[model samples]
Target: MRIAQVCAVVSTLLFTVVAFADVKPNQLFSDHAVLQGGMSVPVWGTADPGEKVVVSFAKQRKVTTADADGKWRVKLGKLTVGGPFVMTITGKNTVTINDVLVGEDWIGSGQSNMAFTVSAKVAAFAGMQDEDKEIAAANYPQLRIFMATTKKTYEPQSEISGEWKIATPENAPAFSAVAYLFGRDLNQALREPVGMVVVAFGASTAESWVSRPVAAGDPQIKTMLDHFDDLYSFYKTHPNATTDQAPSAPQTINARPGKPGPLRDPVQDQHQPTVLYNGMVHPIIPFAMRGVIWYQGESIVGGKAGVAIYPHVMEALVKDWRQEWGEGNFPFYCVQLPPLKNSSNNPMVREGQAHLLSLPDTGMAVTLDVGDPTNVHPKNKEPVGDRLSRIALANVYGKKIEFSGPVLAGMQIEGANIVLHFSHAAGLIGKGGPLQWFQVAGADGRYVSAMAIIRGEAVVVHSDEVVSPVSVRYAWDNYPDGANLINGAGLPAAPFRTDSQDALSAIAKDFTGK
Candidate 1:
């Protein structure tokens, strides 16, 4: 009887061990996935501790042992661009991932703009222009998208939830509109499979997507961390406090407030620094991708301080993401906020965004002409995506195409006028009427409306109000309605200012309440 009882217990223990040892890959490695081509692809998962896991895909095999904590990873060599292949993982259990393709993969992330979908099916996402037609025509099987589930956490998470879906008419409507259009353009141009991994949250601040370490190190944005600490502390002390009783979270400038909830859960607030990165971005690190395309800055916090720190925050984000991904200086492109009225979308924010050009391998899609004065979320996303793809095609794919508009190269004071030189100014012309929105300022630091004329790859500006023009500014307003300086390629010129003294004075005024 004793021997029989011991046998039964041993048998039960063996079954439990085998059941818990079933190998499982990350959600990103499921069926219909697209592996990045021309780079080392990282495949990782969890298995039985000390188990030897072998991953086989497209004539390449990689082997690695699970760590003491049951984590395992293997890097496959560079893959050529082609596949409808199957990947199999063997360990204590066998897992097969089907319909995998090797192609160019890119990350598309930001706030609502990046999260906007192609159809109006979902009420949360404002659908883009030509929704029905765009959705009906979406039948590209080679284009795949993995939309990461929106999540927020106080600490970095090791696992995320999402799935890869091919671009069929049924699925395309739900895909991010900008990402889909960008991928569609790339797929058409390169004649290869393209994948877009979209991780974004609506009405979230840039600081919320930054890593905790990076956010804490920056003095300009460190207050975000302090606020989080205070909120977390309050939650810990008053675990049962209602939303009304809890300390009110600081409102992000021009951001829509989130639904009220229990204060014990700090992750519920998307504005908290690093929460989105912790929950959404951290789990997908080291996934091989060509580059990232970002669209944000409309939800900047801290008022003038927020606008002031935006460029630095974005710079830090780009650098930090590159470092984390182990991809050296990958192309980082962004969209300059378009014109809007009575909102955070202003000249200062756009100027701050332009500072990203100072970084290497970076580009900005100027959207001065694509904005809706009444709505922050413009329905027109076709130009935005096309411009982003234009940058990638020209720089990454070696395509001969105009990727940007006229950029302010330098300014020369010729007589009583300022001549603003520009690159990419081939056949520069005023679209409708004479060049409008130009302002000239003199030593008194006062600006007055000025007339501008296109003069051989440069715009000559002068004002009878200011005889000696020391500085010139073009399209410098929240809603530059008539600003229509475009290059030969018909791309509108980006807004620019020749001097920073006025900007400094504005900042001073903001702080001093003068």
Candidate 2:
């Protein structure tokens, strides 16, 4: 009887030990996943502490020992882009991840537009343009996608929930519209597998993408973050004195009565600085990728002040992401905010997006031609993706193609006229009609509509109201109704200014004395 009892206890303990020792790969590692080629690919997972972990794929097998916390990883060397192989990770137990492919990948990050799906209902579930057609045609098995689940956490998380999904008619309807189209173009152009990891939250601010420590460490961002804490503390300590009104929006909060209102939990708040990064981006660090394609700015483009600080925030984000990846600088391309009705901030945000060009390997896709002033979220996404792919082709795929439209290079104060010289000015052309949105300002710092004519690669501007035009602006307005400037490549020129009147110009002068 004693021997029998001991045997039962030993069996129970053995089962528990085996269960704990079993290895489990992250949700991102699964069948139909694409491993970035031409660089070291990292494969990581959790296993029993001190257990020997081995990863075998294709012709290479890497080994490592799990740490005290049961984490292990192996870096795969450069590989050629063909694979339909299986990856077997073995510890005390084994996990077989099948149908893995080696290829190029891009990370898609941003707000609503990036989160918009090909077949998802429109703003009010009205249905996206060509929803049925696009969903039916999504048959690219070689192209894989993974969208991070929406989550917001005050503390950074080590793991996130999501899975690799193959692009098929059955599953493509819900994939990010911009990301799906972009990946399709890339895979077709490269004639190899392409994968996209879409990690974005609709209506979230850029500050949410930065880690809390990094955001709080910056003096400027800290000022913005401090307001939230102050408001929360004020409310929590004096609940009866909460304000009568909600103050229109989240940032417009007031502790007027000196009490808490509805207890808006900042801990789970999506707008809270670093929450999205903690819940979404941090969990997937070190994933191999060629670059990122972003379509955002609506949340942060609140007004002049927001636009002025946008470039700095963008610069910081790029640098932080690069450092986190541990890979050298990678291309970061963004889609300029298109024309918007009644939204004075769009143009400023567009200028801020253009300002990011100062950073290396950065590019912008101008979408003035495709914009619909009536709708903030434009329905035409094919062109958006094609334009982005052109940038990638020229910059990353060793292809020679015109990837950008004309950009203001210099301004010559020739007499009363301002001759604006442009880069990438191949076959620069304005529309048949009179130039639109060109304004000239004099010493009085006042602007009036100016006459503009395309002269070869330069556009000359002059106004009767201002005899000596010291500055000029083009396509600068909330709804640049008829602004038409493009290169022979058919890409629209980005909105720009040669004047120092805008908020961005003033900040530049004050900050750099330029």
Candidate 3:
């Protein structure tokens, strides 16, 4: 009997050794994957420690050895704009990935809107406009999409769950609507394959997607970490506390009796700083991609403090992502929050989003004219995706096109009037009616409704109430009802304010229903 037991133990040990010896690529390298074109592509995976792994793809072969941790990576030379190639990774065991494509690759991330799918089959996602028609026509074999499962964790993880899928009528319905449209547009315009990896969670904050080390270093964001720490401490001391008794406690308590550490409620508490990054984003670090598109900021918590620090949060996220990816200022485009009724702080949030334009290679897609006042998740995502693609087409792909609407470039104060100069202001006009939603203020800082006119690529504003206007604002309410300003390109102008004053109180009465 003892000899039989010893033999069984030996068999188990051998099986474990053999299992660990097999070379495995990251989930991202599976069949039907799309590699970013025009850049050195990175292919990575794991094997037995010290094992040499050779990767061959698209007429290029690269070799590397797994370190003490059994992790290895190889970078292929810059690829051209076409592929239906195959990749082979050889170590102790050879793995072949077929039907691979090389082309433009982008990462789409943010909160619910970015996660919104092309169809409303899922309970969580609100379907886009003409969902059935769009789904039926979504047959592009050149477009691939990968959606990372939503998750949160206190510590960074090394693996995640997802796979690349070729866009088709069957699969495209589940794809992110904005991302799908963006990829589809690129595939037709650039006439090449396109891939989009979407990683997003509903109601997630920007700070939640930031790395722990990055958030810890920021003074404003560190407070959020501190708050989580306190919540953890409370839960640790009250092991027997019920959910009702401890209202803020994590839903599940997976604590061991004698091993004490920070208790994580990843399921219930997604807003915790760095949680989303640790679980969903960290595992995919350094994945080769052309750029990122983001849509968030509807659920900013912390009241005034949260609203004030949003621009800084976005700055940190953009810089950290670029630094981690080792990609120098790759285009980071974002969607500005659209008009919503009764959302008092939306203008402030939109202002904060615009501040991201100060960073290099960054752009904002204005949605001022494409919002649903009743529904935060508007179904008119075609314009949103088209606008984002316009930015990329113009800025990244060298397409000569008008990618944006009028932006406040300069403001000059003349007696009894404030003249606002704008860039991208060719053929500026108000659709369907006269100019509206323009407001002006005198030295007293009291804003009142003003009349505005388009005058040679500039909007001139004057109010009988303010003879000498000191400030001018356009479409500055939560929902500016008649703000019809647009450029000749038919793109709506982004909301703007010339002064940095707290105008919430001054304009509160004007937007009472909004």
Candidate 4:
């Protein structure tokens, strides 16, 4: 009996060693966990070819075999999102992931400004004293945050590492301030446990988020492809690159003398393609998201250059994301670029941003009235997040409240004056305070300050100096600090340019076909 027991122990030890050596947990529960409501959930894993694998989640079992190249996956059927669950994936060995929750998942993306941190924007927090009380008293044990750890690779990454963290004062502040603020409001407003997957890099153009094959295929996007090649190549070469060594956070473009070189080396900026998408976004495409909130475009805006191609880029990104996730036309909301400091009265970037609204079921949250003239990183994120919530409430969740400020619809030429019609003017009043940042230009194409009066559903604009007004503009400064033209609901109208004497168009035509 003693000899038999010793032989059995030796056999067990050998089996354990062989299993450990042969098994690898190369994939993860994707960054964005799909919410399962009354349906079978698909939980997947990857391993060596022909390797038998088992996934256990929520009292269900799924079995699959790895392909010839050592890859495997499985789907568990019909599980709900009410979980403090653990998923154990076993093949030759066993790997267990704990504290997994099923809930609504969202994608927070865009440029550097979107990637801005809460601690970096100190003032944005000061206004949220009431929110602070709520954050301090937070007890939602089910809420989880999956930060898409930043990476750059030429090929899609098989795995990424980040764990679920409960929202505490210590952990919550480091979260994307915009994403967290938005998530907090949604979690409270909807009363459903929310999970956010932040997959943004600062200073990234819309093109960076798009796949190379998709961008290269579009005629309008080909120009941008040439520009992003080098940036992409750099990302592919340096997968673990970061901006912490620079003066700012993940997204700031630091071209200062002391700054590390561009995210990619300067010499390769035009040589490589799909670097950022491969390294940063490719690995994220498989994760499912309910919707996306984007905050970018500050990096890619050159007035004329922005206008001709930005809309196409927006379309490409939307289409690409939908294709990757296999979800059709999910809600996509974005923050319009705020006011800035240029003497010109015809701002094209804002127009480019507004143009994205032409796409179906998309919303733009304007910040014309909320930005500082010199500070590009605006401190007021609460209103930005709140405005976004209104969209989710109205368009996504189907609530009917006044969610927008005034939006420019069109204008009519009435003799010497231009009558501007606006949407979202249901409860507009202009008597108590000043209505500012209106400009009118004549046939000579020179814009001068004009007196604007809130005339019923339209703003009638005219300048005495220019009798035959060919063009009119509102809140058109690069950074219109005093852009006070907001509705009673406090949402700002995005900056705009009419077809009337568009200077930037002429400039773009000059550069096109060159």
Candidate 5:
């Protein structure tokens, strides 16, 4: 009996070791997950060398063999918009994922506002407006969230640390406020399940999201890279220097249990070069998402080059993400930088965001009026979410609703007055008071405040100081407080300028040479 007991203990130890070394699926493929519907779902993992793997989900099954490196994948056929399905993956051992739903999936990526949770309290941060109320009322099961854990790496990471959770009053407080509101509105409008994977970092730069190879290859982006390299060299040795902090502290993005340390080389942190995309964005690729919504650029905005290079960075990101996902022309939307009391050229960034509409299948959510001049992270998040949902509803879902504000279409000098033509100009009028923030400039190019009133479908402006109105600017400053031009749909018109030789635009040209 003693000899038999010893043999049994040895056998149990060996079995446990083999079990731990067998095939494993990503945590994202686990229970309570939402897969993107209407697309080929990719199931992947690793196993023993040359192991035959089979993945079965819904009514479809696929088989593939693990490579020499133990990596394997199988692509399930396109699925419809409905599921409470179970997925089974079998190799030497079997792994089963349960209670998975199939529906719309989107990625929300950007800076602090994108990272701003309905409830976050820590350094370099503040909580969302009415945080407690928003958290207590949350009870949506279909609006699932998969928040990618923060990990800044110099090289691309294959796996991230996080799990999907159903939105509840308990868990919703930690979810991204904009993402939650957007997903809530989306689910309500589509009447289907919606999931958002937020991979945002506070105080991150645009260059950080673009890969080094891509940035090095592009002339315009390379300029920004060179400047960052020079600045980081100074910041690393001079620890107390006034440089932007790393992309984020691990605890800031998620309320992790233990305190985390800063990067070994602060210069190569997530805020620098391609650190963000390498660490945060890469681990999440090929997840099969519907589209993306972005809200960032505050850290990258500058006087001239910052604005000019912004459009290029936007183009790089759009191209890079689409290339990574292998999805064709997915909808990309972003929120414009709202008004702020800080003395910076935020309008330049806003204009660059507006210019992104020139890209195929891209949209912008104007929030000029929705901003709090005193606060960067505005408390009014519902409107921002609703506006984003409006764009998706009208453009992607085929809903017949006015999704955009009055877009500047053309400018005409109608003898001593500048007449502005607009798209979606129906019911164009100032709200709360008379029209404000309109300025007209003459040949000498000096702008004086002007009187603007709606004339039929256009806004006509005139000023006593200018004889010939060559250019017109509306709400064209860091904080245009009373700029309240909205369309009939009540969406505010984006801040704009009608001059080709404007100082900001000219400075941008000097840097970008475009």
Candidate 6:
């Protein structure tokens, strides 16, 4: 009797150990889980290669085999999203994921500002306020959150470690400020369950977000490559054997009393193609997102490949992301970098962002009037998210909402002055007085703030010093403190240049022409 009892206990212990060691559902199971409404949605996973796999969801059965490399995929036939369903997968072992939800999914990506979390900004505490009850009460049973960890790799990756988490006020503070706000809008507008996969890395350049080989195709990309190579060489030669591994040594040893180090981290400027995509984004490719929103470009501007190559890099990013996502012409909405000090280098990048808008199914949110000259990470994320959502609502989702502020259409040289025409200016009224950000210049090519007046559908700009103006610029300052040219909806028009010039003026000219 004693021997039999001991045998039973040992058998039970062995079963439990095997069960625990078996694959717990790969939380990064699927890049996308479509809201089962009309057609079949694909649900896939990776396991020991050649293992016979079985997937069971809501009485529906699907089977597939692990590929030679241990990657396996299976598609669940079309079903509906009205389920508190459970998903089970079996191969070398069985894995069950509970409280699974099927719903609308959105991909939110970009750089610092877009990645800024509520916990890090001024509005961090505001989320708990009674006024922000909507955000506070955002505990949607079907809403799911997947956050992509920051990564940089030379090649694309197939898996990452993030899972679907239900959204609540408890989970809200850590969410991406911009992405969370955008998702809030979608959740409210659609009145349906929502899923969001947020992939944002702070201070990343546009090139980092795109594939390397593709971005390198542009001759302009060589400058960035050369700059990084030089920095790498410097570090390689000056190897700090003792403290080199520390992140602060490079800055500490190469610094002046009060100024930044002359030699920045050689790695800081290494804007290699797909490095970030491989590490942070590769694990989540082809995520079934309704659209994409971008807020990057600042890092690229300070390097050797600055502003001039901004547009080409943007083009590459759009193309590569779309290709990897396997969706052609996906709606790519971007934020027009906010205004800054006269010394800021991002104005050119902003122009590059504007040029990207001319691409199919693309949109730009102009924030020239909302930037803080001293703060690179602006705190006014509400408007940014709203404007982005407005673009998606109008263009991608086909909602009949007005999407943009006034855009400079053209300038007609009439008499001794020029009349600037703007598009999307349905009710073009200066918020306070006549457009105060207008500037004019003559053949000698000197620009001065010009007197601007609303004349019918156009704004006539003139300067006393110049009787014949050849060029016109509006809100062209790096950071115009008194810029008041906003439409009735409180959206600002992007800065624009009519006649190109040299130096900083030439940079503005590059974007105006593109």
Which prediction has the highest TM-score against the true structure? 1
Predicted candidate 3 versus true structure: per-residue lDDT over 1-514, tens digit per residue: 6999999999999999998899999888999999998889888988999999999998999999999999999999999878799999999999999999999999999998999999899635479899899989999999999988888887888777898988898998889999999999988899999999999988888888899788889877777776666666667777655444433522221111222344445334766778889888888888889999999988776566677777888899999889889989899999988888956337888888887876778888989988888888888999999999999998889999888887776778889999888878888999878999999998898999999999999899999999888998888888887689998998888787877743322221111011
| Alpha-carbon local distance difference test for all models | 0.85, 0.78, 0.83, 0.64, 0.78, 0.65
Against the true structure, what is each candidate's TM-score? 0.91, 0.88, 0.90, 0.79, 0.86, 0.81
Q: After superposing candidate 3, which stretches have Cα over 4 Å from the reference?
A: 1-16, 233-239, 242-268, 501-514
Considering TM-score, which of the candidate structures 1 and 5 is the better prediction for this target?
1
Instruction: List runs of model 1 lying over 4 Å from the truth.
Output: 1-20, 242-264, 501-514
Model 1 TM-score? 0.91
Winning candidate number (lDDT): 1
Following a full C-alpha superposition, what root-mean-square deviation does model 6 have from the true structure? 6.5
- Give the number of colliding residue pairs in candidate 5: 0
The TM-score of candidate 2 is 0.88
Please give, for residues 140-199, the per-residue lDDT of candidate 6 as tens digits: 665666777666654567667665566776776667767777777776776666677778
Expressed as tens digits, the lDDT of each residue in 50-123 for candidate 2 is 99998998889999999999888889888789988899999888899999999998999988888888875533
**What would the per-residue lDDT of candidate 5 be over residues 202-300, giving only the tens digit for each residue?**
877777898777878887667655655555555566656442443322221111122244324544455566778888888777887788999987775
Per-residue lDDT, model 6, residue 270, is 28
The reply for model 4, stretches above 4 Å from the true place, is 1-42, 75-81, 121-139, 223-273, 301-303, 342-346, 500-514
